[model samples]
Target: MKKYILKPGRHQFAPSSPAVHINDTLTDTEAKWYLQRFPHIAKLFIPLPTEGEVSTAKKSKMKSNQTEMEQTSAFAPPSGGKAGQ
Candidate 1:
């Protein structure tokens, strides 16, 4: 299985943010179509390659994941903050 992370409305005021939409593994043709359709958001399901090597598609996926992480971390509370406060 793989995932397609999509922001629901694809707009600045979109109701929600990107999340994994669990999906079947895609064939190359299907992957290409999705890449064109969603551009920067779609990525392989898991197992991002280590830093030593990568394919073109893997590079794109890593970049997308990195961007998502950065956005999330920016507004997240510090480690000592109480969860419900």
Candidate 2:
């Protein structure tokens, strides 16, 4: 099951369940139930990415950054000389 981090604050999942505090980890099922019960505070449940997802995101971000840098350098003006000089 996936994991989630609860936002800062105390929360009770159910009448019988004890209140959870900030930084508490919750399973995917618990998160889903909390969201359904408290849609108004849906932002409180932050999903944690798996190892594979994290790596994939990093790879994509690196690729995009590299592409941007290449594009920028391609349009850079010539150095050490003024135009039409």
Q: Indicate which candidate wins on lDDT.
A: 2
Candidate whose TM-score is highest = 2
- Candidate 1 residue lDDT tens string, 1-85: 3333333333211125554233433355654565676665443333345555557668889999999999999878889896557
User: How many clashes in candidate 1?
Assistant: 1
Clashing pairs in 1: 2-45
Q: Candidate 1 versus the native: TM-score?
A: 0.33
Worst window of 10 by summed lDDT in candidate 1? 6-15
lDDT of 1: 0.53
**Candidate 1: which stretches are off by over 4 Å?**
1-54, 82-85
lDDT of 2 at 75: 72
lDDT of 2 by residue, 1-85 (tens): 3466776678765557777634546666767676688675466666577899999999999999999999997777679865566
